[model samples]
Target: MEELIYFHDHALVILTLITIIVFYGLISIITNTFTNRFLLESHHIETIWTVIPAIILIFLALPSLRLLYIMDELNDPHLTIKAIGHQWYWSYEYTDYQDLEFDSYMVPTQDLNPGQPRLLEVDNRLVAPTHSPVRVLTTSADVLHSWAIPALGLKMDAVPGRLNQLSFLTPRSGVFYGQCSEICGANHSFMPIVLESVPLNVFEDWASSLME
Candidate 1:
């Protein structure tokens, strides 16, 4: 995730520089009355323009490819969870445990607690330990749905009869929210994903409670 963010910022800087240079050239052309009667395209300027863009693209592509490789590399996850997307909710199963599973539904506005954010809160949150590699296997029950968490840099399509996987780790304990990115049905907007990160001991206790 850190690499992804850094690449994004680097691309943005390159884009900003290009935009500024283009605008500056435009303004110079508009404001200045410098026009030669025998003006012709210079090979020097053509080569520079072409080479500079190629160099910029190389800079962008290298990082992008590296990020893709990193994302694709499957690590030895400490825990694995399978997320099954439903019509308007999500069901999760901790594959490591025998019977630790539950359905996660969006909390209606009327049922929200004092500090909970509306439309983003869920009845049950997917919990995991911080500083651990957790893999999520995503698939749909009826239709297409996207299991996504922007904060964790995860977005995988939940296709029927197919399982997609993504891995992530939270550096600190906190709550992260996400929503279905695909347009499935009428209640697609209501289905939300909430992930609660806790310490390893807390996560173990929570899992034990569910098992008991």
Candidate 2:
């Protein structure tokens, strides 16, 4: 996701610079004079230049629209999880598994394990099935917060009195981490999101046991 964002930004920067330089070069060549004398163009000439930019925008809008549509597409999901943001912690509910729910609190520094990442580790990591589409519903109990997972390209705001939905399909079985993006309160930085994607059978077993 980081690489994708970087490449997208790089493309925009390069294209913007090239477009500006090309437009300036064309104006300079057509005017044939560096002085301000050539700047006083006729109404028709000014209209032509304006229309040229409009034409360029039409071409640029196609790709921009496609990217927007692709980013908003949500596939058929196999499981659903609702994440509710509290004052300083997160509560997750498996909506399809008898509504089994748990609170995921930030692990203290002294409790950190060798493999655990400081500040991003939680006591109860969210569990999902690998290679399956998981739809996430988000809401806030108090102030606003944001749920984000970089590896799966998932981010949504947990607004009070409203529900927002986002979905992702994990291609591999592993743990992915993220943090609350919005600053809700003093412990906002401590609200980390941890996802554990396991095999389908394993996930089913865990979910069944959780309901019991």
Candidate 3:
């Protein structure tokens, strides 16, 4: 999400510039048409419209292609977590560690802690280290599901018997939340994804404790 947010901000800047240019162009065209009429040849007008749009498209396409490339650049991950979507819950297994796994169930609103988000809090949160590449392999236990974290700009469908991989890094230590994006069945709303990003040493300690 750290890099994704930067990309989004860049896109917004481009869009804002485009909007301003179009607005000014429209105002100028309207003014010229009502005041001084200089009729250009049809071919000349066609060429102007076509070439300008082509240039703009190229400009837009360049950034879009760069962003896509950035999105696809999967690095050698430091940690890998396997996520299995069930009927009404998400179970996560830390593949890098031995026998470290947990089922994450959404914390009911009535049971939420002081700072916990209602419906977004989970009993078990997937923990990872900050500023490191993390890979998530997703699959389904029963039906179709989608593991999505909006902040990270990550969404991968969990298909039964098939695995979908997602990779990203947290810029800093914090808590990020998400939910099952796919409409699996009746209790779909109860499936929430909670991620706790901690410092590298803190993560190792937690993982070590789990092994004990």
Candidate 4:
């Protein structure tokens, strides 16, 4: 996620620089009284314009391609979880643990706690330990759905009968919220995703409690 944010900032800086330069050039042309017809046909100016843009594109493409490759590369995961999308809810399974599975349904507006967010609270949250590479496998039991969390820079489609994978490592413990990005059906807006990151020992205790 940090890498994703850094790349976004890098691209934004480049885009801002390009926009300023182009705007300045446009202002200069509009304000200038001198008309040089020969300058319009100058191969030197044409080459400069073409080469500069190409160079800028290379700068953008190199980092973009690098990130792409990194995202596609799956490392050895410390833990694995499977998230199955239903019509209006999500079910999760801790692959490393026997019988550690549960269904997460959104808490209705009337059932929400005083400080809880409306349409975002869930009955159960997908939990994992902090600072560990956790692999998430996603698929749908019904129609198409998407599991996306912007803070984690994670998004993957959940297609029927086809599992998709992504992984993340959170440096700190916190609760992250997300929603189903794909429009599946009538209650599409109800399904929400909540992930809780805790310490390794705390996570173990929680898991053990569930198993018992």
Which runs of model 4 end up more than 4 angstroms from their true locations?
A: 33-39
Cα lDDT of model 2 by residue, 22-96, tens digit? 899789878975555555556876997789778767766665676566566677778889999998899999888
TM-score-wise, the better of 1 and 4 is: 4
lDDT of each: 0.93, 0.86, 0.87, 0.94
Lowest summed lDDT over 10 consecutive residues: which window, candidate 3? 33-42
What ranking emerges by lDDT with the best candidate at the front?
4, 1, 3, 2
Model 3 Cα displacement at 195 (Å)?
0.4
- How many clashes in each structure? 0, 0, 0, 0
| lDDT value, candidate 2, whole model | 0.86
Taking all chains together, each candidate's TM-score versus the true structure is 0.92, 0.79, 0.89, 0.95
What's the true lDDT of residue 37 in model 3? Answer: 34
Clash pairs for candidate 1: none
Residue-level lDDT tens digits of model 4 in 1-212: 78888799999999999999989988878998437888878999899999999999999999999998878777889999999999999999999999999999999999998989999889999999999999999999999999989899999999999989998999999999999999999999899999999999999999999999
Candidate with best TM-score = 4
Error of 2 at 145 (Å): 1.1
